[model samples]
Target chain A: MILDLIQNSFDGLAMGASYALLAVGFTLVFGVLRRVNLSYGPAIMFGCYAATWVSFSFHSNIFLLLGIAVLGSVLAGTYVERLCFAPHHKGSAIAAMVASFALWMQFEEVVTLVMPKHLYDFPPMFDAEPLAIGPLSLRAEALVMLACALAICFALHRMLYRSRFGLALRAVTDAPVAAQLAGINVPRVLLLVFLLASAIGGLAGWLIVSTHTQVTPMLGMWSTLKGLLAMMIGGLGSLPGAVIGGLALGVLEAHSQWFLGPQARDLIAYLLLFVLLAWRPRWMTTSHG
Target chain B: MTALLEVRDLVTAYGKIEALKGVNLDVQQGSITCLLGPNGAGKTTLMMTIAGILRPRIGSIRFAGEEIAGRPPHAIVAGGAALVPENRLVFPNMTVLDNLHAGAYQRKDDFASDIERLFTRFPRLKERSTQLAGTLSGGEQQMLAVARALMSRPKLLLMDEPSLGLAPLVVEEIFRIITQLHQDGVSIFLVEQNAHMALKVAQHFYLMEQGKVTFSGTPGALAEDEVIRRAYLGSARA
Candidate 1:
């Protein structure tokens, strides 16, 4: 029982790390713009799809595929920003979100049109067997995922706190008018942050798809749901909180799936969100930005 | 002396509701100019318009002989005018030092000495330089706001409601700093609700009513006008 708990904990945390990366990207955009990009997951899916298509037509290295995934997501993100977020910035936030959802449909259809297959195989990160500790086993890919998430979080923290651009970004996040008066170009900051978040989402998507060694149309909705869930669980618009929330969610889901079942896993995860919303609405609703 | 900041026939609006209707105002070099008005009189609107945060529908804003009517806020700040916005909107999450750094974001020069100078001017900000702006007390936040704007190295400083919410002693301290800044040759265009405090420091006063300049005079003239005194120093003053 003890060994099982330890093993489950490690697997849960590894899964949580991926969710944390997704959450971080979501939180960055939300933090600065104070708007949800509903197309976030779809954008990532678009990149993964681009790579999958590339793989079918040509034999490219996995690392090159990863680059294509990130680039494609960023390009999709730029589309969403220009067509949705930019014009609606000073306008209604609901309008922007609705427009983003509309584009989410566009992304889904575009991917489906090019690649009608419901599922496709992707190049995996490694063919190595799971690494074993004395009593527990861990996937090498999971370790990479965990390490990348932590490293990205640390780098982001440093960039935000240590660099001039970060200072201006935080200033813009704090109060946009004051930032403008202080001579920070508020619009440029918004665009840069959105692109940065999109790129991060793309990287997360590449990692997840490689781990599963499979791709599906559902990846868009799945990535979006998981990212949104983790962001809310951590606390809205907090970097560190998003990561913690992601991990907590992963552990909770892992334990529930282990003890109860798969359906119970999703149910308990959502139930926690519902309870959190009901008990402390502020945590879920407040935009820390 | 030449005007450091000038506004001629400025008309600004929110949709069709004209907030500042053909207003004419100017701040002389090295003078503390105060704008007094009731809640809906558009005092803040005029300040925002002048600062380039809000564009004027029709008129001219010439700062230091440059036409800056339609320019962006950062360009205005870059051209040597900084607005210490209303209610002390400091970057609450950032440290005081970071907030100061944000002020100099437009400048390419080294502002180490300027930061040191601001610390000397607002000692409380120095004591809490590493602390977040949100954690500071109301007065300290106000000082930080002032210091943050000063980081831009403006010749003309536009301050809106600096004494809006603060203790009596803190207000006095703010006024003292304003007086000292004027003596140091920075032109100040001030918006104040405190007529009594404003009358003390301001050499020139403009009274705004329903988005137009109703009265422009000395402190004595401001006090002597029956309509102006009753409206400005009436229920709102208390």
Candidate 2:
């Protein structure tokens, strides 16, 4: 039982890495804009679908597919930003969120119209066998996901703490008027942050699809639900909180699925979210220190 | 040489009600000029318009012998003028050092020396460089706000009510800094309610009432005017 628990934890961490990336993207947009983008999952799905379409049309390198996914996500995200967030920046945040949701529905319909099929095959990131050590096995793709998540986290930390752009972003987040007086272009910084978040979403999408070796429309809602869940579980607008929340969620899900079954796994996840939201943990309220 | 800032026929309105009705003012080069006004006397509106944070309905603002009206706030800051905003709207979550960095966002050159110089000017800021701006006392936050504006190395500093909501002793310290900055050759356009303090530091003063310039003259003229002295300068002062 102990070994099974450890093995499940390893698998859970690998899955959680993708969730962490998605949560990071969500946290970025939320922190800077102070508005939620309901269509985050749809944007990633749009990117993944674009890559899948390209793969179906012509055999391409996996790296190229990753690039296409990222590009497609950024394109879709820009559209959402321009159409939804930017227009309502001065008007109402509620209007912006509603518009984003409308766009989310639009993305789903557009993807469905373009691809007619319910599911499609995707190229796996790694064709290697699972490595076995001391009666434990780990997938090579899982290891890659874990490494990418950690490296990206480190890079993001460095950027936020050590760069001029990061300082401007934080200033804008703290107070937009003060930021403008400081000569930091507020709108441009917001757009850049949105683009960054979308790019990260694209990466998360690519990681998840390639690992599963399948693409489906449901992936959009799945990614959104998981990302939002992870973000809430971690904290409102904190990067590190998003990461820890994502990883913890993944482990919880994995263990529940192993013990109580798939339905119970989801039930427990939702229940945990409900409890966390009700209790309103202190860590969930504060952003970065 | 012309005044550092020249405002001609400036009219700014909010919706239907006009806040500034054809206002005219000037800050001479290398002089600390002050604008004295009560609440809702269009002082903040004028400061915001000069800093390019508000769009005037009709006006011409000539800064350093060039027209600069309806330009964005960032452009104004880059054009060698900065506004130390009212209420010291410092970024509350940012550390003091980071707030200074944000102020110097537009500069490409090395600002390390500027930081050192500001630290020398405001030693309390340097002592609490790592502390967040929100945790500071009202006086320290005002100092941080002033220091932040100076980080842009502005040639003309527009300060709006620097002495607002501070203790009498801290208010004197703030006035001392203003005098020191004026001595260092920085032209200032200040909006103030404290007439006595303004009388001491202001080379020229303008009294604004209900969005119009009611009085404009030297400190001697301000004291001699019976209407102005009884209404604003307090009954205890001559």
Candidate 3:
């Protein structure tokens, strides 16, 4: 029982790390643009499919696959910004959100038509062998996923807090008009934000496919919803909050599945979300400026 | 002195309501030009228009002999023009140091020495360089706003109501900084409500009412007019 509990917690942490990446992407875009990119789900889905295509046609090297996925995500992100977000950015937030939703549906339809298959098996790039440490058995891939996620998070934190681009981004985030007066190009910063968020979303998608060893069209919607929920729980627009929220969500889902059953996992997670929303509506408010 | 900035027949509006009607003004090189107007006289609008935050419906603004009427705000700053915006709208969430850095966002050269110079000018900002601008006092925020604009190394600095909503001591400090900047060879275009303070530093003055320049003269000319003096310089001074 003790060993099973340890193993479940470890599994939960690995899953949580992936969720954290997605949530960070969601929060970062929302923070800068002040609008939710509903197409983020489709963007992640596109990344997974792109990585799959590259792996099958050429090589199955993990680093190369991840690179392809990031590149795909960046492209998709730029497309959404140009087509769905930028023109309407100065308009109502609802308009941008609605446009993103439309793009999301378009992406879903495109994927359905192109792939035709309901599910595709992702090629394994990491050893699936379990590593035992002091009676707690953990998969090597899961460990690698956790390490990768944490490393990405660290890198993002440093980029935001320590770099010149980061300072410009934060300046834009704080007061866009003031940023303009200060000689910062607000539009360029906004585009950079969308690209960064999309790249992170792609990384999360790659991790999810690598761990589950499968890809599906449905994964896009699922990941987006989970990421949004995690962002809300962590406090929207707060980076540290998103991380904690994602980890908390993963742990909660794992414990729920273990205690109740696999079927109750999503149900319990949503219920917790509902409770959090009810208890702290103010906490969920986005405070960008 | 050659005009550093020349504005001719500038018209700006907000949804059919004209705020500036065929306005004409000029800022001479190395001199302080003040625009004095009552509330709703479109002072802020003129400053914003020059800063490229607002597009004039019809006008030509020549700066350093180059026409720059419809350029974007960043381009205007790159052309060596900067606005110390009204209400001291500093990046509230950013550190004082970061705010200073952002002021020089367009410059490719190293700005470390410029920051040090600003620190020497406003010593209080240097002490709280790492603190967020939002956490600073109103006086400090205003100082940061001025310091931030200075970081661009602008040849022409436009100031709009730098003394608004500040204590008497703070207001004095702001005017002192204005005088110091003018002495340092930076041409200034100033919009101010305080006509008494305007008389101290302004080499040329324009009075606007109902979106038109109603009066233009030196401080002596303004002082000689009883109606203008009482209306603008305050009852105590008049």
Candidate 4:
């Protein structure tokens, strides 16, 4: 039983890493601007489609596909800002949220119209062989996803704390008015943030698509929802919280899958979410420390 | 040489009600100019207009021989003007260091030494560099606001009521800093309700009433008039 639990936990880690990346992306944009990017789900789905297409065209170098997907996300993010978010920045935040949701629906419909709803095979460059060491076994793809997630997190940490752009971003996020008085172009900073976050989302979509070896238009709705829940569970605007929340939810779902079947996995997630809501840290409940 | 800031026939309004009605003023280069007024006398509106936060309906603002009447706030800062807005508008969630860094947002050059200079000037800021501006006391936040504005190394510092809501001791400390900065050759455009403090610090003064400059003079002239005493000190002439 213990061995099974251990194996499940490792499998959970792989799932957790992908969710964590998505959570980080969502949290980064939401925490700074205080608006939900509903279109984020479609953006992720589009990223997966784009990554797979690039891999097929460019001869299956996983690294190249990942790079291409991230670039696609960045471009998509910029396009959203220019077309949807920027014009409404001064009007109403709710309007921006509605626009994002509208865009998401539009993109999903477009994708559905373009491609069939059925999942298509997408084989990546990574070997799918399971490595057994002692009494534990782990999939190579899962380990790769976990490593990439950790690396991205580390890079983000450095960017936020050590770089000039990070300093400007933090200033604007903390107080946009203050930042403006200090002469930082707030709109520009916000757009850059959108681009960076979407790129991260793209990378996450790539990771998940590669592992699952399939693509579907509805992939975004499920993953982005999980990311949002994880962000809320961890603490809104808390980067570390997003990661911890994602991992916990992933592990809980895995255990549920092991014991009560695949259908019970989402039920377990909601249960844990309820528990977290009930026992959320008092200081964190207010959000933003 | 022209004044550091020149405002001519400036008019600003909120929706329908005009706040500043065709006001004209010129702040001499490198001089500490004070604008005095009662509450709702359009002092803040004028400051906001000059700082490029508010666009006047009609006016020409010449800063250092260039027109900046309708320029954006960031552009104004880029042209060497920075404002320390009313009520100590420091970024509360951000640390003191971060707030100060935000101050230099327009400046693209290396700013490490400038930050160090600010720390040397305000040791308290250096002590609580990592502490959030919101957590600081009112006086400390005010100091942070001023320090943050200075981080831009602005040629003309537009301060809107820096002495509001503080203990007498803190008020005095703020005045001392103002004096020190003035001595260091920084041009100051001050708006305040504290008549006594404003009188002491100003080289040239403007008295705003009902959205117009009712009086403009040196400090000595304003102190000599009985009507001025009644209006400023709120005391009836003997």
Candidate 5:
């Protein structure tokens, strides 16, 4: 029983790490543009498929695959931002959301047309062997996922707090007019924000595909929904909150699957979200830039 | 002295209503100019028009002898003019130090010395260097706004209601800073409702009412007008 519990917790941590990346990406875009990029899910799927192609064609190392995926995702995100978000940025948030949703549907259709198969097996980057320490056996991929997540979070924190570009981003996020007065190019900052967030989302996609060993068109929507849920649970604009919320959601989902069976996993996870939000509406409040 | 900024027949409108109707003014180089008026007198609209935050419907804004009307705000800043916007709209989520750095966003030079210079001028900002600007007191926020505009190393500084909502002591401190900045060769274009304070530091003053410049003269010339003095400078001074 204890071994099963340990295994479940490890699985939760791996899933949480990926969710953290997705949630942070979503929150970063929201913080700057003040609108949801519904196309974010498809962007991640694009990264995953791009990585799959690189792996199949070149048998490239993990670093090369990640690089291609990130680049591809950044390009996709930039296109989405230019076509769907930029023109409607100063307009209604609902309009931007609707536009992005349409973009997302178009992206899914393209993915389906390109790869009609329901699921394609992704090439594994590491051995699936469990690394055992005493009685606690954890998958090596899980540990790697956790480590990568933590590293990305630390890098993101440093970029936001210690770099000049980060300073401009935070300023623009807080007040665009004030940022303009300070001589920061508001449109350029917005573009950089979309690129950064999309790159992070791509990294999350690569990590997810590595663990699951399968790439499915439905993964895009599912990953986006889970990431959005994690962001909402963590609070909208806070990066640390997204990480915490992602991990918490992952743990809860894992435990729910264990107790109520896998079929009840999403149902229980969403119910918890509803209850938490109802109990503390202020939990949605974001404190930091 | 030659005029550093010249506005001629400037007209700015919001939708159907004109806020600045054929207003003309000149800011002389190396001198402090003040614009005085009551609320809705188009003072802010004129300032915004000059700063390129608002597009003038009809007029030419000449800065340093070059026509700069209808330029974007950042381009205006790059052309050596900065505006300390009304209400001290400092980035609240940013730390004091970050806010100062943001002020020098267009600058590619080593701004360490400039930041150090500002710290010496506003010691309170140094004390709360890591604190968020939103958490600052009203007086400190005002100081920050002024310091931020100065970061652009602008030759002409346009101030809008620098002492809007502050303690008497803080208001005095703002005036002192204004005087010091002028002494250091920064030409100022001040907008204020405080006739008492405007009369003290300004070399030239213009009164705007109902979208027009109704009066233009020195402080002594302004004091001579009984109706203007009573309406603006209070009855005791009149």
Candidate 6:
């Protein structure tokens, strides 16, 4: 029983890592652009589809497929920035948000029309066997996801704190008019942020697909809501808040499955989110920028 | 010295309300010029229009003989003009050091030495290099703002209300810094509320009311004018 409990905890943590990635992407985009990218979910789903097709067509390695997925998402984000967001940039925030919803629906429908609705199971990225380490058992794919999430977080922190580009991005996020006068291109920095966020989302899709061995049209829909919730519960636009909130949600969610049963887990997640929001109304508008 | 900045009948507006009405001005190289007036004088509007933060409704602004009225603020800075905007618009979340770095954002050259120079000049900033700018005293934040603008290595620095809400000692320090910069051969365009401080620092001054340049003269000449005395100094003692 103790062994199972420990295994469950590891599983919870690994799952939380994925949520951490999703929440980071969501919060980063919102922090800079001040508009949530609803298209992110459909973009993630399409990226998964592209990854599956690449692996199937060329019999390429999982790592290569992961690279393609990330690249595809980056391109998608750029296209969205150029065609949709930048032009409407000076307009109302709600207009940009509604436009994102339209883009999301359009991408989702287009991908569905092109691909089969039935699940296309992907092969396990690593050896099918789970590793037993003391009291904990962890799948290789979960381990890889956890490492990738941690590495990405660490790299981002360093980039934000150490690099020139990161400084300009932060300045633009904080006070755009002052940033402009200081010679930072506010729009260009925001575009780069969107690209980074989409790439992270694409990597998340690839990881989720690897673990589940399944790809569906709606794969990212639930994760998108969860990501938004995590961002809100933490603090909108704060990097640390997103990471903490994501990890907390992941652990609570995993344990809910063990304690309350799988069917009612989502209700518990929502309840916790509600409780957090009830306690901290200011979290909704908080941003380090 | 040649004119470093030239504005020809510049007109700017907020929708239907015209704020800058055919205003013209010239700032000579290596001098401190002040624009002074009562509230609603459009002094801040002119500054914003010149800095490319707001597009002028009409007229032209030339910086170092290049047309820069319609360019974005970043491009305008890249052309060697920087504005320390009204209210000391410091990035509140950033540390003093970070704010200084941000001021040099457009320059590809190294800023470490310049930053060191600034820290050396303002030991208070050096003492609190890592403290968030919002936490700084109002005077410290204003100093940080000026230091940040200097990081751009601007040929012309436009300071809007640098002395606003500052303590008398702090205001004196700011004026001293302005004089030091002027002595160091940096051109300054000052928008000021304290007429006495402006007279002390400026080589030339313009008085504006209702978006028009009502008077322009040397401080000594303005002090002697009867009309200017009644309007600005409120009955100048003969």
Q: Per-residue lDDT for A201-277 in model 6, tens only?
A: 88887888888888887776866887887787778889888888788888888888988899868999999888877
Worst 10 residues of 6 chain B by lDDT: B229-238
Reference-based lDDT, residue A62, model 3: 85
The weakest ten consecutive residues by lDDT in model 5 chain A span: A280-289
Give per-residue CA lDDT, model 2, range A103-138, as digits (tens).
889988998999989999999988888999888999
Which regions of candidate 1 fall more than 4 Å away from where they truly are? Answer: A281-289, B220-238
Residue B184 CA displacement from its true place in model 6, Å: 0.7
TM-scores of chain A in all candidate models: 0.97, 0.98, 0.95, 0.93, 0.95, 0.94
Give candidate 3's whole-model lDDT.
0.87
Best by lDDT: 2
lDDT over C-alpha atoms for residue A47 of model 5: 79
Which window of 10 residues has the lowest lDDT sum in candidate 6 chain A?
A280-289
Ranking by lDDT: 2, 1, 3, 5, 6, 4
Docking class of 2: medium
DockQ head-to-head 1 vs 3, winner: 1
Task: Give per-residue CA lDDT, model 5, range A1-289, as digits (tens).
Answer: 8887877887897889889889999989988888988889888888788777778778768888888878878888988999888897567899989888888888788778877888888866696678778887777778788998899999988998888899888998898788888878777889899999999999888888877888998877987898899888898888888998899888888888998899989998899889877886665764554
The lowest-lDDT stretch of 10 consecutive residues in candidate 4 chain B is B229-238
Interface RMSD of 6: 1.1
Second chain only: TM-score per model? 0.94, 0.94, 0.95, 0.94, 0.95, 0.94
lDDT against the true structure, per candidate, is 0.90, 0.91, 0.87, 0.83, 0.87, 0.84
Q: Write the per-residue lDDT of candidate 2 for residues B1-238, one digit (tens) a residue.
A: 4699999989899989999998899999999998886678789999999988889999899999889999888989999999999999999999999999999999999999999999999999999999999999999999999999999999999999999999999999999999999999899999888878877898888877777787788887635465355336433422
User: In every candidate, how many clashes are there?
Assistant: 0, 0, 0, 0, 0, 1
lDDT of 2: 0.91
lDDT of 6: 0.84
Candidate 6: C-alpha RMSD to true structure equals: 2.9
**In terms of docking quality, how is candidate 3 classified?**
medium
